[model samples]
Target: MAYSKLCITLLTVVIFMLAANPDVAVANEATDELQRQIDSLVRRIEELEKRAGQSLNVPPAMAATGAASAGNGALQIGLSGLFAGGGSSVDNDALSRLQGGAHDPNQNGFVVQNVELSIGATVDPYFDAKAHLIFQIDSDGETVVELEEAFFTTRSLPGGLQIKGGQYFTEFGRQNKRHPHSWSFVDQPVVLSRFFGGDGLRGQGARLSWLTPTDWYSELIVGLQNAKGETMTSFLNAPGEEIGGHTLLDRDARRFGDLLYTARWLNGFDLSDTISMNLGVSGLWGPNASGDNTDTRIVGTDWYMKWLPARTQRGFPFVSWHTEVLWRQYEAGDLGIADRETLRDWGMFTQALWGFKPGWVAGLRWEYATADGDTATDPLRDTRKRLSPNLTWYPTEYSKLRLQYSRDWTEHLVDGSADTLWLQVEFGIGSHAAHVF
Candidate 1:
């Protein structure tokens, strides 16, 4: 009896010990699973932070430390470019204009060509920076390159106001920002030459623009420009100049070396969304455009309209027109000196673009101009006229082919006239922010 009682008591004691420590087994099983989940969460958080840093273009360490450096604040990087080349001809008896030689062809010694590159990025939701570079070569393979523009912009203001700084194109007319590559026509209207002196309108300046929000779009721009324009020293006989023989705008003498101003206003409304029209009026006032101390002032307007219907089963068709009239007021006209100021300058031009296909377009342009400066003695008596027509075909989003015919009339340096006809082949592309023209 004593032995049995002892054995029973021992077994009861063992069972009690096991029951008291039941939580130990459960904790061991749950702890491993919970620990695994915690580790995964930590790794996931680290990856997310890394990606966020990259999106801001911020250095990972800097991001982690929460510092906003200028180089690391960009949100997106943009790239754009163009390449265009074609042949040209004019009548032998017509006035032959020697454009920036890079656009010359062998037949007429005036081929068409263009090459451009641009880089842009948004530093923040409301701030941006842009840079444009150009490389153009004539049919003879002579090259001329330029820095088209470089500017920084910010829009952190009330009523969508934006401030721009650095060298920029004046918003005097449509073509300042109206890139030829983005245009449907192969050539610009004649008015641009009279109003803004074509590409010479580019200037070193600062501009401030305010864009108002609404279905009716509106914007205002003011510019303070360097009246000397593109310096002849940067492009000419100063040595190392690759201008296919000569540069375009600098053929004339220096006009203004200081304070030149330009201002523009834009207003437009949505013509049922698919079709729209905009009107821009601009003015530029400055001194001595011809280096004769004869103050020069010009004013003009630009109109743009687009038409796109909801249904176009037969591809897409649209028409566009650009026109301008300019009257250059000369403070000192009809001076007796041989190289003296002789007359006021005035000219008018209009052009149209028609789309035959999504990427194909046809264009026509015409202009009449009379400048008192052509002949240093009789700047006004000289009348210059141009008539141009062009057709283009695009095989892809990045390529274009164009054909153009034109006539010119100028009674300047030569006699009656000279003209010719030309056929050209052109290739273009937009990639990697660089162009080959």
Candidate 2:
């Protein structure tokens, strides 16, 4: 009996000693902390998988992290500022035409390219919403505020279908839907500026997208939007604008055919463990304000490919190529009018980027644009060619510095060509959504 009592007392003493031991307590706490961390990671992975299944493209590296950080039902707010300093061989007025893009830097000195505020959130199980507000300082030193995009997208739908509506960018091409802060180059593509106006094509609209059940990723998108705005450059632009020598009139949408109709079929393929590709064809048809019965049609194709090693660090040491070709047909006047004519124009741009190391990228772009007939004197329709090379360095995921040089060849320029150099800087704060692949 005495031995049994002594054994029990000794065991109790050992238990008390262990409970008081700092190392043991620390070990217990560490185990609990590890469990908590594992739970968090598991939750994040599940959320990411859910998003991947719903999204059209898989985001890379830091972008995925940003999306995950937003968490379910939480709002994400981000602000980004872009600034540029540059000089061009031509005067400011001529440079404006060369730059073409509303967001591009057009003057010889410092310019505030874009300041944007973005807010997004998952509204519920059925919907997600986002908005972007843009602020810029024009050459006249006037502050301009614009509602870039405000849209809602379906979160859950049957049969792999989704709908988006409200004021938004038309998904005419990969680049058209991207914001200025997401562009690889410091400026917008020359072809996009010419066809979609200084601002990329966007308007109040609704779109439906279907994610087909295929071995590889495939999606079909159809959209209907108002056709009469400055953003619809090839269609019913604002009054006083002239296209193909035909003055635009104040035209209203009298029928469903007067609205812009857009369609795109996009496909994605995993060519190999280390490479991926996306190919898409798009079309737009709508009424034009050039004449009472005239119309316009635009078609385009885009191809994108990226090569990464089976292993990557910070999504670095990769190569990507993107190309887009566009053609436009414009009916300039009434069929019975003496000056009636059918005008055709086409343009293409190709660009490649090499991420040689973490946060460092080198890029080159080539562009060519021309139209049928003797349009050499018309800045918008003339034969224009440009070559641009740029280098970018990202100090961190949220800040970057870039320098670019462009050589322009255009028939409308007095010098026949021009050289321009620009240095750009951008910084962002808060959680920004991941860019699409």
Candidate 3:
């Protein structure tokens, strides 16, 4: 095993060395650094394995969830980081995770930044909990302190109700609920990116959810949050905040009731022990958006289905079809508009996920939107459409790497029309944070 390990390390070093220089002796600086880290991790794991065989010298790493395993559950700990920089036709949310990458000419370029460290425990009775410290890299190259998520839960909630608190996701959209690093592209869809902005926020409040008790698995969630709104540099120079650059209004600012609801169901038909067709519906609703106040509301929904067919003796092949719609309505959007009353927008997204290999999935997405009644500057007053092809590779249970390309075209605009071609690559890592809902 050690010999094989040596070979892997040596191989990576060789590749990087070759890329460095054509005449220089093979000296892989970057690869060497990475290999050393991986080798150290492997050595530690090997030592732990050997000790377990003879006598327990050290405790096993617990799973991030801290839930005792049906299969010798062990405590698991992990570390992760990412850097992304990319250019684009417009500054959207799709490339939210990647740090440095090429982009379009007309679009704005942003540095992808996030530093996360987390720890968790897996306890007996199928329960687990985790705590995370999230560091956000702002556009102005400033570091911000925020609590990402901290929660625990059982693998299977009997009554389908999973209760969670502390800072975590707000259940706005499937993508919103998940970390940005897990996305295929560096940016999110236009609607989501435009509507939600970034990080969104973890309402330091509470969340409740219920799952189906049937063979058809389904889950529903209701969350009440404590927010002043999104967090960022202040936007207003009013009496309260300091000199503001970018102000995030939707932190936990639910005057009437900052609430969110989400529901999803899966209908799986067994086609042999390992093959099946899984179908379902998912949706989310809440008061969200940059300008929306207590009386305003933003809601979203998704309808989807998937087919998993036995393609190879040792490989699984599957494809999914899904659509999502998001809408935002503001009660009074007039900072200074005439008879300013309501501003509403909703967009639709449909995509398919096809498993090309055991750990590789490739798919495409089509998004469209129609905005009704907006300030004279509403670019989407007519309608919008775009298509994106995304590919993803999950190397382990805890990490994923993705790339995507998209073309956006629109007729209506606040001023001139804009067309864009965008590309993105992203890597996601983190098995240490799990806030169950």
- Work out the TM-score per prediction: 0.64, 0.84, 0.63
lDDT (CA) per prediction: 0.52, 0.82, 0.48
Clashing pairs in 2: none
- Candidate 2 contains a number of clashing pairs equal to 0
Q: What lDDT, from 0 to 1, does candidate 1 have? A: 0.52
Evaluation by TM-score, superior candidate among 1 and 2? 2
Q: How well does candidate 3 match the true structure, expressed as C-alpha RMSD? A: 8.8
lDDT of 1 at 430: 18
Q: Please provide, for model 2 over 72-108, each residue's C-alpha lDDT reduced to its tens digit, 9 standing for 90 to 100.
A: 5777766666767667889889999999899998887
Better of 2 and 3 by lDDT: 2
Question: What is the alpha-carbon lDDT of model 3 when measured against the actual structure?
Answer: 0.48
**Model 3 weakest 10-residue run by lDDT:** 97-106
Among all windows of 10 consecutive residues in model 1, the one with the lowest summed lDDT is: 232-241
Decoy 1 TM-score against native: 0.64
Off by over 4 Å in 1: 1-112, 138-141, 183-191, 194-198, 212-215, 231-257, 272-274, 289-294, 312-315, 332-342, 372-381, 413-437
Cα shift from native, residue 39, model 1 (Å): 55
Against the true structure, candidate 2 has what lDDT? 0.82
Look at candidate 1 and tell me the lDDT of residue 253.
Answer: 31
